[model samples]
Target: MQTGEHPQLQQQLMVQNSSGSLSFNSNLSKEDEEMSRSALSNFRAKEEEIERKKMEVREKVQAQLGRVEEETKRLATIREELEGLADPMRKEVALVRKKIDAVNKELKPLGHTCQKKEKEYKDALEAFNDKNKEKVQLITKLMELVSESERLRLKKLEELSKNIDSLQ
Candidate 1:
């Protein structure tokens, strides 16, 4: 055998005549050929079974992924519905708060005006009471002056009458 030459598998063929020589035949024995074929057939069957099982597993995984996708979509829809349900109340609360702010804005100026008008009414009432008191004082003074004038006139009339009787 050479250093780089690989050994070959063969059967020796025996010749009956022709100097009874032996020659290497390239084909294997019948029993060895049958065994090799049976082993190759078994390997092919196992490969086919593995491939079928792989396909089944792949299909199952794809189905599970599809179901997960659908569930995720449903969860998203539910979240949207929940947000929708809460939005109206938020809007209503915001509107009510705005109305309250507007009312407070109106009330501030009105309250100031009411206070101003109340002070004016109080000043007017005080002035009216002062004028009434002044009127009462003036009436008392007039009554005193009338009484003095009447007494002086009656004394003059009696003096004049005595003078006229003496002359006659």
Candidate 2:
């Protein structure tokens, strides 16, 4: 036996012409050939079964991949809608801020006008009070003049009466 020789060649050499081993006959009966054919058919059936199982697994993986793709598309669409909503919300916030500023702008002038009108009203009230005080003083002076004129007229009448009595 050489170190590098084929194992099948060595086995054949050992098996051939050995009286210690039982050798099979070259001519096989029909029953023996039928047994061989059944074994070959069983091996073919097992291979076909394995191939069918592999095809079923491949189809299942393809279905899972399709579902994953659909889910990914749905998520992407939802993300886009959220982005669109956010943009509008941001714009609405900006518009609200502008409206607040405009309201403040309008209120500032209203407050200033209210303060000016209040000051004008106070000035008018003070002028009216001063005119009323001057009117009261004028009325008091007219009354005093009238009383002095009446006293002079009564003194003249008494002098005339005394002259008449002396002459008589």
Query: Which model scores highest in lDDT?
Result: 2
Summing lDDT over every window of 10 consecutive residues in candidate 1, give the lowest-scoring window: 8-17
Q: Give the TM-score of candidate 2.
A: 0.37
- Candidate 2 structure quality by residue, lDDT tens digits, 1-168: 333433443343346424455343455456544544554466568879999999999999999999999999999999999998899689889999999999999999999999999999999999999998998898888788777777777787788888888899
Q: Residues 50-158, candidate 1, lDDT per residue (tens digit)?
A: 9999999999999999999999999999999999999989989999999999999999999999999999988998998999899889887877777777777777777
Question: Number of clashing residue pairs in every model?
Answer: 0, 0
TM-score each candidate. 0.39, 0.37
Which portions of model 1 show Cα errors greater than 4 Å? 1-93, 158-168
The candidate that achieves the highest TM-score relative to the unseen native structure: 1
Error of 1 at 7 (Å): 75
Clashing pairs in 1: none
